[model samples]
Target: MSGLTGAQAADLTPIRTPAAPQASFVDWSGGYLGIEGSAGASFGAFNFHETRVGARAVPDFKTGDATGRSDRSRSATTAVGGLFGGYNWQTGPWVYGVEADLYGANLKRPVASTAQGLGYEGVDPAFSVIRAKTDVYGTLRGRFGYAFERALVYASFGLAGANARILATEPDLATGAVSAARRDLSYLGFTLGAGVQFAVTEHIALGLDYRYVDLGTSSRFDLGTLPGPAGGPLSTQAGFTSHQMMARLSWHPGGLTLPPEVDETAPHDPDNGDTGRFSLHGQTTFIAQGVPGFRAPYTGPASLIGNQVQSTTTATAFLGLKLFEGTELYYNPEFSQGFGLSRTLGVAGFVNGEAQKAGAPYPKLRSNRYFVRQTFGLGGETEDVPDGPNQVATRRDIERITVIAGKFALGDYFDGNVYAHDPRVDFMNWGIWSSGAYDFPANLPGFTQGVLVEYNRAAFAVRAAYTQVPKEPSNDVLDPRVFRRAGTTVEFEERHVLPFLDQPGKLRIGFFSNVGNTANYRDVVGLTQAGVFDDINDAAAATRAARRKTGFYLNLEQAVTADLGVFARFSNNDGRTESLSFTDIDRSISGGVSLKGSAWDRPADTVGLGTSMNELSPSHRAFFANGGIGLLIGDGRLNYAPERALEAYYALSLSKTLTLSFNYQLVVNPAYNKDRGPANFLGTRIHADF
Candidate 1:
């Protein structure tokens, strides 16, 4: 698919070939694969009607009447991610192609509620809710474009289809109990869009595009009769239109087959000295987990259901740019989908580290981390730094001062252990991988804005940070108040030699203080017990004010031999207040051993075993005993005991940058409720980094 003539290749000399024409320098004539992320809004309307009325139906209720249907305007902001592939045929300045893409998306309309029922319905304010949602969609399109040197401007039109659903949750007026019903649909329509793409390298291109999709009105779906005497069969239909703006990155393998002489002169030559200034790397991880049937005396809103399977997937891209000496900027954008078993509830020491509080059926695109780092080097011994994600290769003095500001995860800098820190390649249990009681400040995706400063030396280091906390307990939104409501953390690190085994080891001690709009457990429980409120949770909600939580953690990692290591952690927090972030554990202690495959044969494989015991403070236990719920766990009434977890895993290396791990976890006294279960979890993880 050369865009140039045969005569042009023979006449070009090695030295002057670098000055070739734009068409030959960057080819747009081959099959390409791409990943795209989009964020925009969806607009729609849903119409609801009662097809049949029962004996106790109100006189004012009209079935299938022209003006009786509940017609509500619907709208929502949406986020989506997906993949595409296509082949392009380029003839000089003109190019033609056909492309198809499929996406998992979160496009949901707001809930429309019906007016309350009449007095004789025997229910207080009985209501019904209706909503429309789209989970997956795709487009099959043909493209036409004009090549402007390194950029291509294109337009496309095609057929579109969406997997949509209409959901309803209504109260049975006679019993005053709520139930739900849903109808799934496939909508076929049309799509059109235009975009511009620019070649960043011979094999890579970046683009931005906008599209408008129409999923025509859906057919009426009849939901059978409701549960109570005053209820009736229901039906609904909706029409949807969405506008999306997407960013894309693609790779073309055909560029790899270019003539060696020409390839060396391309912009992304491996021998270029300036290449180290910019770094781009990516990783994708998938984890599937399941639990078998277990014994349970009762189940609550947050109880883990037995005999269930679930999975989660995440894809992340890390991009870094060095602006000047000792200064760099980095961004990490990620797409995540799926949920944990029981929707990430039940277990106090959760089995999946990658699962977040917010779970979705479709992929959601988010910028999880963006930060700027500045380093000040002091004259001393120099050290070499190898290139990796978010880190550029360079040499720096052993003694230096580093400062970082912007948004990131607090775990990135604190309570880290070499043997158990990363869940993607190593352990998968939250209690084993992290200081479970630290309660670090974070949003739903486990990220927050902050500023950190560190002083490093050959043998020791000191670091501190000031960050934003959640606006309220267990909330995703961060508080803007820096001084009034914020988080501050400090850590001290010491690298030393163990006299017993003559091995190297590191020790870290961290302290954290967080101030936020949280309620006190004792206060809420007292209000609930005094007949002032019906539930402890509702009482706590009404009593929230400024409160402070403090905690500390100790982390240690030591090497026992060339192929073996051991790590441990101990963390605790004052549990008088409600949990602000993280799990429900108020005190935790964990330890583990990790062995490398060098012990046997495969040097890249590893095996690990860990155990943890998590406990809730007395007051925190009383809160749950009174039917209060924290972030991840609460089982209605208390059979209070320390939650215990045991985890083991074997990670088999498929390649230098890929691994498949098998994991197992045993959680006794889940959520610290002894009457519940000794649940067992089985999991598998596939991870890749490049």
Candidate 2:
């Protein structure tokens, strides 16, 4: 009935056999890149050889005769970190490779002494001081190793190089004259090391190594004519040696096929391996500006006048954590010092947006930004988000809804321009960076507590926010009462793909309103006319009450090419009341262009040009005409004119992490007063980030 006989049934029965066990050993051959931290002691010797020739032909002093010499030795402990890249090949039990590495450290020592009676009649003594420092070093090495299972022991010998600095100070005791010289030198050296590396997994390995390096000697010489026997040549020599121990973690791209037991615990994505749930990042910027012209006829408590040099420095740390799925918390702590040009007064469109009106000789530390953001996905296409400061690498739906609450800058969510937003990286003018007349809500440092919600699709997005305003005009403290007195903004954005380069462009329209204690400009002017007070500020202070100010702005950014982009912003506010926050700008229009220097073979360089025009309303202009000062700019008597400014800058990228920029600005009718002037400002900035 089954259609099978006894012999056929026997043939149909299956025979089972155990599969052969998989190999236990891993193949350790491939190219790898890693970062390492090192610590150790550096020992070095400095030899100073000095030859003095006589200035006069006499019995006691002869010309071209050797006079003095000195030699010294010192040591210092140092810590360093850097990157390493190399390739390895393994055959049988032997492994060989070539590797290169670079490191930066602070290894310094000071050598100082006094030379007695070195001058003609023993009446003059000279003091000499030298500080020797080694800042950066590198190595190119060949490695030979023996492999046993998952571990390897290796020996390396390499050619080494280092950058050294010698700072010398020499002072004459008789005349109290001092001469200083700083020399940066590069030295060639050699290195020897031995290390052991063990594979934590097929793709990751941990290594510990010790190296001894010897940097050859460098010499400094000076020839000059002096008053007496010391008029000759002086020479100094320096040498360096160091012993360093380093720990390294490396990833081998070609050796990622791991056994099942190790694969379960290994990192899923090696490129972003360390980016788990928490991340930290930081940046520092220092800018110095000098204004040559624009001196006013008279000065007020807050006025820009005369020639001045001002500098500002800020350091910030960004800390972020993922609380749960689709939710993240971020905190930014910042420390800042220095003042803007003219204590951030005089010009309506201030030259430095990074600077604050409040001046402090010491650094002031504050919590700049603290916020929580949560995203709800609406099933759609996916997009890849890159890792950055306060951003984690992940995938997100193209259509989503996001809600953010807590303290942050309003500009972070609204009124963004591609070519001109961050003063730290792009345009440095307050008017150019944002919609000047919009006067979004904020305290002294340009941030506030708020709640923002955003909805995004493939080519369109809308955002709205309600934020706290300062307790009073230009105050550093917020009102804290959410509904009683507050500020609100709504923005609509459209993104398009341009036809020329398929590049994206964006247009945003925003409306804002603030309700708080403010004075009417027209009322202040009328009170001053009625003989109540000679000063408009006095009249304004006497009539302070709750009022509302509303404004609107339009922002546009378009990419013309792969290397060129342009941006424009226009804004206006009802000038019935005094400024609640930000600079004194009632109406403004600004536009700019940014070009990458790829056409000239300097791809990392950028050039920018921009212009801004700002105007005051009828009531605001009348108040200033009657000797009223509203925050930044007021001349005693007013010859009112629109404030106009043009700015240009070139930024050169010295390295991937460092940038140097030179900028210039020309301003006409500063503070909206014709009497003030056409001012010129020159500035330089150094920015570094990690």
Candidate 3:
């Protein structure tokens, strides 16, 4: 047997480097005994025929031809981990060795329907939310390899085992989600692979490899996102082999092996700074109507024959400047549209879910933003105005730089959300405000702590915002909704805590209030705002006009126990006579019990998670609770923007910068009410702050 040279001997030893935050603890060996670790992200989403925001204002029906293939994927996440050493015995000029990969991932796949049935195929508009989970907890790969001098050939026959927990794989047609509880399955996958590797130098090397891995099948988990065959027994015919043939390069200097004498000659600059950086990322989508998979009303309006191709898409760009240490000045711009499949003439397919129309494709959109990470912001925004029938209005926005200080801020800030709301001209919505405010720290002697005094003069200068509401589509197919609405808002609000009243784990006094003007609906062409499901008529628009309303909200809570609490809410409104008041204007009060708190008594060490684990917000973040309840009271903001719901929820922490929570919301005066009262159900979300 030939022994390795001095340099090769050093390379053969395990690197023992720390694993990358996003990589697995898998090692690669070279020349029969070389160990390796690589961290990179992967994109496994299958976007067969999806134009989320269409290309040229196209709608679903008018989108391209359907292939019935939905896309279920996860972007490759960068993983960090290292491998151990393994001996390679060479016989007949061939070498063999064994290797293992020890690593974990927080993988999830959110699968949704991309193609709803055409023209109301109506059999429960195929839908699903494949709460995808891909966790190959860890794998020990056994390998036998071959080596010919400097080059090596290898084969791996290993158990690609994983601890998996699948969610609504088989969804319910009625709900377009899962029916039963999660179907958890432990899978044993056999992965077969072969590759060629070469050592470029004593510290750098490269290789190429391929794999065919299979995790046996189980129940049908159709990620009904694509228009084609969702996952099932039929979809099973397609094997679980994701083929990849790539070239990779590696470098292992082993912590500056240069000797002390040579190090003295190296120059040094102990400064880490970037001149400035700019980045841009965006995706565009397009859809057209009157195509194969869409439906149009046959009798109603001949022009409404439903053969329109509406396309909607948006592209975003960002510019940033590192003004100093730990701070940046940023500017971002976006241009978006909502339809290309169906023409702006109100193609009914996307209007009523009965035939698969939820929210109308936005006729037009354009916006610009500029903000400083720890300072001031100056920017402008604009959008196409909505007109009656099939036309949209053109609106523009402008902002001047203000409040560029750190210690105290006495300037004003205006946040805006505007759109056509519908294909209605006069039925427009606009909100404007110029307000001043003062902020105080939570740790202060004066009663001013945690108190933000803000007073703004805002209202529809022209339309006088009675209330800007969102219009919901009468029906929803397989897509989530995108609302394009125009509304005017003028208001004043305040939030603060009571002095020294910080009774630990006890009653806490807080106050919040809001006041705004009422909206006028007579001019609204569709007689509905964007994202609303109001079904009246042009004639009813008059009566609904009698329904435009606005008001203020107040909430207070007190801790009763370590996990229990109590709270109350108040809605104050102003309408000429109770008769003209909208349903949300009613006044009622209710009280209920609440329970929520941190689950972990203290924090734990996560240094072993990955190399980049320290890239998060902080070393330790106290997990807090956001849960409360109040008896059925006056109707909440159930219109365009659903009210900040009052529900029973327990938010759990996942890490310093992430939280994994499961909440069960109790509907009070629910927004989109079903024949049955509000739904009491459990929902989950993972919150992460980058």
Candidate 4:
């Protein structure tokens, strides 16, 4: 469009190569996504025609004289910033691609005009003002470029659209009265730009572009003038044109590669494998949830009430180091704050897994995990492990022994269900994320000091762990006497490839036992019967002793299709003893399906729907019926029913490293009590990882 012929512009200019080529040039052919910041000025012309107005006149008002038309126009400048993504197809030296971007803008201007003695036979005086603003804009463009080694110069042209606000106000100078109208309009137009990019690395490029955009005029005549005899219908038209100078940074995931300058012959570091010697990653999650209204009989120590908003936030940094052959150390430092609904109480399956029971006004930082993992390959088939948080990309034997020790969550080692593991990116309910009744072992923040041993074969694996639990029920401090007061778990997992579905699936069964100072539900009942303050909670204090609680759970995850998977979990814990940690449920069953949005052209997006039913054992129910409270669930009195929960969520990938999700939950018979009603929770979450 700029006058150069297709032959001259799209074809790369021939240039002589170096006498002796050292390395191949950077490849610019690939899909790229990036964030960019831009500062620019938008020029806009707004024209307002005072065709007819119903307002009081100054000296006098004549209908015909007031109907006369008047026009005023003005223009101004603004700033903008946003995100863009594109893919390029390279044939030889020519690159062609399409890009899309959205930006926020602030381009506003005001125009005023005064007419003295002009309306009624040069006797009426009036003043008119118009304000115009452009709030948002986006573009879709096709770009063509020719590469010269590590640099590319390109031109782009695109369709553009914008949202604008127009306000027109007129005041009769003689009457001190005002008439005003406002209109919001969507305008469509075109844009053209040119830029040159220089590759800073094989995968990263920086560039600057100068773009010109023109948003065609939007006219509205339906905004009737303010109430008055001299005010009628008014017409307003606004147009915008802008020149932007934007600095852009682009990251090509497929283009990340090693530089060409490395030596041909160098000793390889054994510990690094293919992922290098050290890795660092971080993630931040923020969730806000609330219930609009729910039925409740009476509020107890732990009861969900109607109309409440609760939010939680967590940020974590993962650091990994390769220590020696088959050995690695990983540590995670985290900061968290805020509380779940009802201070993380009420429901057996409490919402907001990111929330801790003890929340502080300010962020609380803790060493969440520090562990050493050693793997011994037994000479067999291998599996590839991709680089991720706390993990180094590498290959390991399918038949191997893995030893892990230090501080970590027991969930990290056992009863892992693929459909609902990560609260930051998947399901947020506690019961669904892990086996609710298993109560594997953890301090207040859901971590423990432990050692784990795993033996893996081609299609089967066995794992066991011994960890320290809290010193007392629901306490945050771990018991120092790990051998005396500890938690142990064993699990077996079998992997299968289904014949008809041609998909992979896993079935895991686990058993867990925790020895700690805990109270017995029956003993609490007995104490209450013996006039121990007439409260079951008081009976719990009188019955505290060193006890063992045992539980078992079955977990299954089956991939039904390439983009669809289903998971189910069934767990039961001894109901005689009070819950030492985790939720109040003694028996639970949960299942769900997860689907990838590849069918809709959004492969990174995910949707999940799940339901869970939790029940309390007879003694546990009796305690609650006698006004007793466990860790999370309680009601003044109980008309017992299974705590049933249905959860659904849709997670949208904003970028490779950012995701946004909307979650909904429906809970019937919260806290296993029919008196307290069905509650609905709505939540929004944002997660970013790097």
Candidate 5:
């Protein structure tokens, strides 16, 4: 529960080693399933060779490190499983054989927490989670053969290569493993196979085969997260498929032989199909305060809720393609931005180029957002109509359509909150945005199924957007009784996702709005109130209002448990108003928790409601359970019309990327509040997700 400090053992001691044991594993031992059917059936020829084991899962560095997380299998076993074996030589219409193998990968770890801000003794709040293992043999593979066994089948060809090691472990208080990372990855492969086997006699036989593994290279990692340092884009090429139904009892004593020569090139057939894929992509954060030339005195106060700067670094590259068979083409790019981002105190400000530094007005911008999307659209499988083979309707599948435009900000098109992913709402990360999304497949789980229609099948999706605001004036209504002074505001969003009513996590009903056209500025006379700042700096000139906005959104992400999960969200906004009201508006409701076990993995919990409000989270008050709407005292602002207030926090899943928090916030500004004690109550955060 405590370890790593002395400046984190002199900032990670020249990369320490040997200290990986939170819970790790990876297994392999040759022979990845073999076959050779026919004994009491009606078909002959098969093969077998299978062996796997992948271990190196030493999580719980906290609770649920990051999200691609997976632990809990301490008994369900298989830490990214793998195994391989070789041999297959048949003879009849003709056949051949040859093989060899080994496999394993590095999950990675080297974190030391508690340094997000606010200060403490060498940073109170500790860290530790080790389990680093590295091993990767010749990683080589080979397969050669031929066969025309049944009435309609035969073909296989393969080539393989491997040598891997990418490990890191950081946890030290007394010679543990300060820091140690190793990298060396390589893999080249090709395979194509077709199925049809039916033999149940002299030996054994069964059917169903499909093989397509073109590990050409495309699955690189280094995330980097924020601005400069983590590393970018790396993914050779990937296409994996293995749906086999086997049963082979062969006694290769010298009866069926032939070992060499075979190359059935269907280069991944289906009209030369190669819809490549290899993903491991990656951000949001900020903590800058009072700008103008740095006054540096721990200046605290003057917040539009949050974003004392915060642009949160940046890096992303989500790529995957399969343009046919229901459609799929998703490519998201941002290449690189700031690695670990440090403009001194944190924050990039809403995101667009982040809190200007290297020369203002728009300094660093590297936006690469590409799109041609379809995950499932267009379906009708039954081909044959040259003259009258019957079964019409050729190729009419268009269930996926995505067009993304970016200068940035629509929550970067895809990554939390527009319809809400989890915390974030502009701060000078500024302008430009466009979006489109699609999802389908359902068969009455919650009483609705339509992705076209396949009886008992249901799944649906929708998203729309427009973004670019923040030229200034949104850090707390900017005074003037609070109505309109800042600039740039026009946002619209919508979402409808529902499935899994039996409950496990799946529900979304969304709506968000904003419309602020302010800039005629000039008001403050005779102190009708607003008193000093030296008498409102010479008050005069005030009305030119046209700030109309609207808002609504709700989400429920399910997966109650493979380990644990129970999520919920609710939002409300007035955007500034020309219409709709409950008093200018700002409402919230939240509750969260998630966890997986073994050493525990994938743990998350966000709780807030009662007009809930979140400020950069990791653990905002132990997953706060709803709170925040308004009216708590004098200077307080009861959200204007309706005045609601209740906030919450509760985060626990400490590992993979770390998060241990607890906070409770309730706000009102009739100007400043008239009652209540310690500002009303609870606060804490021990967060991280990298």
Candidate 6:
């Protein structure tokens, strides 16, 4: 409660000029919605007692002794975040409220295994592992508080709930083969906490909060058949307690306040007083996809199962603030969960572009992008910029210089295609949405820190950027060595109008180079063939050294009519060294057509159809034939053929901000193996934006 006051000095600074300070009294009554993040530690104890079978008693697995009782305790530090909402009532200096929140937590112990150093040597051991975790928890609380000017002190008492689980994996007693068992319990208890908040603006407040929670002892849970000679059913009881400290930022829309002004006759244009200083936007996308059985002669480590269904969900908040004239800062915080089909393997041209390489068992919060953008006008015609995600409404010169720095996806700048750019709304195939052969540098989530500069004129634009790559292929961490291990890219774009049809079109050419610790496909293959290593992956690891990879791409988009557009991309890489990021593609070409449904009186709807072909280089194919696996695709042996995909989708717009799409894809020779299948996939996507 000790931060700066006044609406003008809040985190989101306004863009207007000259307003004397006013409003000394603050009001704290409203319904509020916000995000809260906490860090803390949890401590708990578990007691397990074996139950005898008809003729035998289970060995005390927790300990080597014969005693049936096993008691142990564990503590873990964790970080949790989620959404919170509540309403408060204020009378004089007293304020009371009731609040509820749910959070995904990483509170669990490491797996305890009994097979350490036994070197059963690649054979399945007749041993077991035990572990316990709490994945999700929430609370409903009643609060009481007192307000002093712009600050509030409060105390809360609540009921807390958690889903607690224990997992035990072991080998079968009779066959000495692997088996698994699990038990789950729901716990309910109480929580108590206190906190303070300082109102930074009439509708926004920043606060720090603390709470202590206790989930009382659980009833004995019975875990099914244990695996040893004395195997039997096992019962266990556990209790949980934790303390957390959280930072919160809440918006009281119900108590909205407007700045003092007297401009009823002002023009609503950028030169006048129309645009706001800050913009808030959000989007959520959920995709469900499935594949039926296909012809597969044999499966390898990265092979996609015959039949499977998977889903992924992502939600992001786009917050932008004007820092100074012609400059803005934007931050995008996202929550991602779920998995891709076959754990995102077995496909060079993956079916789902939205599927991330990293999967999470529960929703995880991450700051995916945060950056600053500055624009300098170069004395030319002005154009209107609409309000949207990461962009605020304003009028800027058509010819200008812009500089952007921070963390973001390179695709956001390069590979421009109006008909096949956004996967959530358009094409869903990676090869169609982007140039598959260009190994753009990125971490697992497809983002990197960099500086980008662009020069724009009425008919052309030139862009360049230098960005960080991952520490290793498909790694989640970015390398910090800048020039020693980074990526540099440059692109030139030309805008034109077709003479015959009088339709507009654009052509883009881009070149990229990356320097990193990489291995040559031919070198690694040679090492494996000489018997220096049994595995091609191990040979590649041993041969990794400073190497360079380069590529280029050509992209074009043309509007044929008022309601129809077409796009195409052709890209190729050197294919000498191993792929550092992106997928296993050396050369690719894709084309697509998009049509608006205005002919059927549904102008907001869209239909698209696209096709792509991806090929691997000769040496790259030989490496895979020797059982080398890249980031996404390898099937032990190669019957090599070009990976081809055909995709079609129809999006039905439910409203201005919501859409439902149905998609179908046919993949020929999945992962470029002629012996395998022409796989078919069906998918649905629900997308919302505001």
Question: Best candidate per lDDT, number?
Answer: 6
The number of residue pairs in model 2 that clash at the backbone is 0
- Give stretches of model 3 more than 4 Å off: 1-328, 331-500, 503-535, 540-550, 555-646, 668-675
In the range 10-84, model 3's lDDT, one tens digit per residue, is: 988997988654311113234233333222211122222322312111122323335433344523221223333
lDDT values for all models: 0.78, 0.76, 0.29, 0.76, 0.28, 0.79
Which wins on TM-score, candidate 1 or candidate 3?
Answer: 1
Tens-place lDDT per residue, model 6, 58-150, is 334445434334444433433366788999987767889999988777766633333322323443432555566777879999999976545
TM-score of each model, in listed order: 0.71, 0.62, 0.29, 0.63, 0.20, 0.71
Q: What's the lDDT for residue 244 in model 3?
A: 22
Alpha-carbon error at 452 in model 4, in Å?
A: 0.4
Worst 10 residues of 3 by lDDT: 607-616
Worst window of 10 by summed lDDT in candidate 6:
110-119
Residue 523 lDDT (model 4): 82
Whole-model alpha-carbon lDDT for candidate 1: 0.78
Per-residue alpha-carbon lDDT of model 5 for 1-690, expressed as tens digits? Answer: 989878878976797788854211111111224343111111111010110011112122234332213232111100122344455543444334444334332222222221112122352233212122223322233434333221113455565443434333323434444554444556565645443332222222233233333334335343111111221221111111121111222222322222222242323323333333322222222211222222122221221222222222222334544444434344444311111112211211111223222211111234334333333334544222111101111232334433333222333332233212333211111111111011000010000100111111124445554432221222211122222421122222223333544434455554544333332211222232445323221221133244544455455555543544454555544322221111112344544444433333333444333232322111111111111111111121211222223444455443323344453443332111222111222333322222
Error of 2 at 340 (Å): 0.4
Better of 3 and 5 by lDDT: 3
* Model 1 Cα shift for residue 235 (angstroms): 6.5
Q: Is candidate 3 or candidate 6 better by lDDT?
A: 6
In TM-score terms, candidate 4 sits at: 0.63
Return the lDDT, model 2, position 417: 82
Candidate 2: regions farther than 4 A off: 1-275
Tell me the lDDT of candidate 2. Answer: 0.76
